[model samples]
Target: MTSIFYLHGGPGMSVAVERTRYPQAQEVHWWQQPPATSCAPHPYLDLLEAALVEFRRSVKERGAPMTVMASSFGAHLATHLAQHAPESVERVVLLAPTYNPEQSALRLARRALALHAGHADADKVTAALAAYDAAPGRARFWEVFGALQLLPDVPALYFGPQAGDAPRHFVEVLQQPGGFDGVSAVAISDDFAATFRTPGRSAFNGPVSVLFGRHDPMIDAEHDGPIWRAIFPQASLRMVDSGHFPLLETSLEACLA
Candidate 1:
C-alpha cells in the first residue's frame, strides 16, 4: 500500500485543521516543516527534500514511493521534491500551490486592498504595501502579503463562510508561539522566494492533482492553471468554490474527487 503524506502550508502553520479531514481508518503522515529558524539559508526546498529522501529510504519498503499532498508553501516544496527525488513520490496533490511567490504576493496585496475598500483598516493594507515599496525585501514582501491575505477581518479570504469553525481553527494555529513569525522567516529567506518566481515544470511524470480555490486571493488560477497544466501534462486540475485553504473550505471527499 502506498503511504500518504500531508504537508501543511505556512512553513510553520499547524496541521491541526488539515489532520481533521483525514478518515480515521486511513493512515496519513503529516509532515510539518520545522520552524524556519532551524533550517535557515535554504529553508523550504533543500531541507524538506533531504528529509523526505531519508524518510522514503527508511520506510518499510525501502525507498518505496509515497503519495504527497501539500498545500501553499508546502506545495511549493512538494513540487521540488517530486522533481529532485522522483523515485520517492508516487503521486502529487497540490492545493493552491504558489507558482510564483512574487506574483502571488502582488495578487494578494491587490485583493486585500480591494476587499478592504472603505473599511477602517484599509489604511493597514496601504501601510503594508508602503513598507514593501520602500524596501522591496523578501521579509517586507511577506508582511505585505500577510496584511492582504491574512487580515484578521478576512477569514473568508482563506476559509469561506461554509467552513464552520475552520477559520477559528486556523487563527488558533497561527496563535501558537512563533507560528506566524516562523512562516515569515521562511518567506523572507534569501533564496526561497526567488526559487518559485518561475519554476517552469516538474520532471516527475507520475499522477498529479492540482486543486485551486475559486475564491483564492493568492495566485490567479486563470493565469497559473495553464502553467501548472503545462508543468504536468497528465495533471488533473479542478477549481472549487472556496478560498486558499481548499482542504478546510470543502468536504474531504469533494476535495479528493
Candidate 2:
C-alpha cells in the first residue's frame, strides 16, 4: 500500500473521520486543516501549501510519491496540490470532491439553506444568510455554513451506513469548543475561485480514482462527473449507491471498484 495523507472534509469538522473509519491498512498521516498551530492563518492556500511541502518532503525521504485521499472540501485542497505540485502526487483518490469553486460555493449555499427551509430553523438560516450578505467579509459565514451541511447530510451518508453512534458523534463534535477553525479553510480559497486550474492530461499523468455517490445532491454526479473525467486521462470514476459520503455508506472495495 502507498503512503497516504488523509485529509478530512468540512468547511466545519476538523477530525479526519476517514482515518479511523476507513479501516485501510496503509501508512497514513492524518492531516488536519487550519492546524492547531499559529503558523496557519488566513489566505489558507499558503498555509495548506506549506503543510503539503512538509508532507511531500517526508514522503520523498521515505520512498514514494504520496497518495492523497480527500473528501468534500478536503478534495478541493487535493486538487490544488496536484496542480501546483504534480511531481509530489503519485496517485489521488477524490471522494465526492467539490472541484469547481464557484459552482461548489453556490451549491453549498443552496443545499444548506434548503436544509433548513420550511422547518423550524428556517428563519435562523435566513437571518444568518442575510447577516453574511451584509458583512464586509464573509469568511466567518463560510465557517458557520460549512458545518451546517453536515447536520442533515452526515446522518444518512455517514452514520446510517457505518456507525451506530453517528448522531452522538455529530452532536458531540458540534458542541466541542474551537472545532470550527477548519471552516476558515473554505473561506480562505474564495478569492481564488476564478483561478482554479482544471488538470489536463499534460498537467498530471498520475492514476486518479474518483469515487462518487450517485444520490448525492450536494455534489451531483451527472453535472460534475464529466468535468473530472475530462481533466485526467487515466482517471476512472466509480459511482457508489450512496450519498456524498460513499466510503462511509459503501464498502471500501466497492469504492475502489
Candidate 3:
C-alpha cells in the first residue's frame, strides 16, 4: 500500500481535518513537530525536516510509493520537499497555496513583520484587535501583524460558519509559548517570494499539480495560474468554485481526482 501524508496549513494548525477527510488511505501520516508559537528561525524547514523523517519511516514500513496532500503554507513545504526529494514523492496536491507573497493582502503581513522587528508591544496589538473584534461599528482591522497575533479570529473573517472551531484551535496553537518567533516569520516572508520567483534548480523530476480556488484572496489566479503553468509545463492547473480554502469546499475531491 502507498503511504499518503497530509500536511496542514498555517504554522499553528494540526492535521485533524486531513485525517478526517482522507481516513481510508493506508498509512496516513500527519506532520506535527514544533508548535507554531515556538521561536524557531525557520518553522517551515523544521516541520519539513520532521515530515521528511516521518516520510522516510513510512516509506520503509509501507515499502511503496508516497503521495503528499498539502494545503496553504504546508503546500510551500510540500513543493520544496517534492523538488528536493522526488524519489520519495510520486504525486503532490497543493490546495490554496500562497505561492506568491507579494500579493496585496500579504502586505499587511509583511508590515506586521516590520512592526515585530521594531519592538512593537505584542500585548497592545492583541488588545486592540480584541477590541475591534468586539465592536460592531469599528472597521475590520485586517492587518497582517494583527492577524498573526490574533489568528483565532481569521476563520471568522474567511470561513464564516466554519471559522469558530478552526480559529479557536489555531489560536490555542498560536498562543503556545515560543510560537510565531521572529526568525520563522522572516524565513516565511523570504521563502514565499523565492518559491515562486526562482524555485532554485533541483532534480525533483516528478509530476506536479497546482490547485487554487476561484475566489482565493491570497493568490491572484489570473496572474499566478499562468506563471505556475509556465514553470511546470507538464503540471496540471485547476480552479475550484470556492474561496482560499478550497479543500474545505467541494473542490478538494477534484484535487484528489
**Candidate models: Cα lDDT each:** 0.70, 0.63, 0.58
lDDT of 1: 0.70
Q: Where is the poorest 10-residue window by lDDT in model 3?
A: 136-145
TM-score of 2: 0.71
lDDT of 2 by residue, 1-257 (tens): 66777667764465535555654645767766554334444455565676577667767786777887777767766776777777888888888877764445545565666755666555655665666667624454654465455445434433334335544555565456755565364545553452445566436778899887666656777788787877666788887666666656665556545
* Clashes within 3 Å, all models in order: 0, 0, 5
Best by lDDT: 1
Of 2 and 3, the candidate ranking higher by lDDT? 2
Specify the highest-TM-score model's number: 1
Question: What is candidate 3's lDDT per residue for 1-257, written digit by digit as tens?
Answer: 43567777755455555545555644557665445335555555566677777777776776666888787777667766776667888777777776654343443333443446444454555554455557622133334344455433333333324323544544455456643354555454544443334565445556777787765546776777766555456667787766556665553456677
Clashes of 1: 0
Q: What is the lDDT of residue 27 in candidate 1?
A: 49
